[model samples]
Target: MAVKVAIFDWDGTLVDSVEHIADSLHQAATELGYPALERAAYRNIIGLGIEEALESLYPGITRADMQAMREGYGRYFFTKATTPREVFAGVTEMLADLRGAGLGRAVATGKSRRGLDKALVSSGLGVHFDITRCADETRSKPDPAMLGEILRFYRIEPDEAVMIGDTIYDMEMAQRIGMPAIGVEWGVHDQDTLAAFGPKAIVDSMADLRRALELL
Candidate 1:
């Protein structure tokens, strides 16, 4: 089936912000008297929203404290941390190509509205997305509300859309909604795990991604 819309996951898929994310979480954890998370564990839990991620990483932490930590981390990352978020190579070209082909593009992420805005501004790829869905405005990944809403808003059928992500949540969201998915290898999750989701295709590099979408 042809793909008319391309929905992307922001964090691990388009931009490599895992280090910034880990640093922010580590600072938050330290301030909250909790241990820092390992990079791999952090990557695995990132698709969940802040509250869920906190609960998963720091079991027994109070909800209020977790909320406070999230606030503190967001403040630090947005204001203090100017860490350069590295966009995958060829992303700009790929987006341009997709747009030239008349494909729609949007983002569905677990990042809060404020956080998503900050990252997009920092990454300089904000203009590439026609619509951006944040956790604050919609249900988080695995819930499929984010994807469903984007599809509805654009008047695109699920079969006419494809989700491109680096994590399982992206795959699950697409699968649950009956949309095609293309798992990117450079993102957070293991390529093997992404392949297990039976993606219509899995891209090893951004160039490969261009070819995959072209074929679609």
Candidate 2:
């Protein structure tokens, strides 16, 4: 089916912020007098919202501790963020092409509304996406609510939209919602893992992603 709407995941899909995310979490933990999270452990929770990520990482965490982590991590992430973030090569052109081709662009991400909003403005890509759904604004991924909302908002059926993302959460979310999804290898999870969720295709680069979306 041809894609009328293109939904993307922010962190790993459009912007290469894996290191930033991991490092910021580490810094926040240190500042909050908690032990630093292992690199792999931090990497594993990239697609979840801050609260969910904290809960998943620190199983018995109290609400107060979670709030502290959130504030600390957010402070470090925002202050250190160079603004607009570094986008993958060809992303600008890809978004421009998608817009020019008359496709509606949106974001369904694990980032909080504030985080995603700051990124959109900083990265200057806000104009490309007509609508965006964040984890804070809806249920987290693998649940399908975000995609369902996006589909409903645009009056587009699940089959008419293509979810382009980089994680298992993304694939499972779209799959459960009856939407076709394509994975990007350049994100947080490996190709094998993303493929495990049965994406329509998995592309390794932004160029490949653009090509795949074109085919869709």
Per-residue lDDT of candidate 2, residues 88-203 (tens digit): 88888888988898889899999989888888888888889989999998998878899989998899999999998888989999999889999999888999999988899999
lDDT of model number 2: 0.87
Model 1 Cα lDDT, one tens digit per residue, 69-176: 998888667764323437777787788777877889899998888888877777778778899898778787877899989998889889899999988888998999
Counting clashing residue pairs in each candidate, in order, gives 0, 2
What C-alpha lDDT values do all the predictions have?
Answer: 0.82, 0.87
At residue 117, give the lDDT of candidate 1. Answer: 84
Model 1 RMSD in Å is 1.8
Highest lDDT against the true fold, candidate? 2
- TM-score per model over all chains: 0.93, 0.96
Angstrom error of the Cα, residue 77, model 2: value is: 0.4
In the predicted model 2, the residue pairs found to clash are 84-122, 84-123
Q: For model 1, what is the alpha-carbon lDDT of residue 185? A: 84
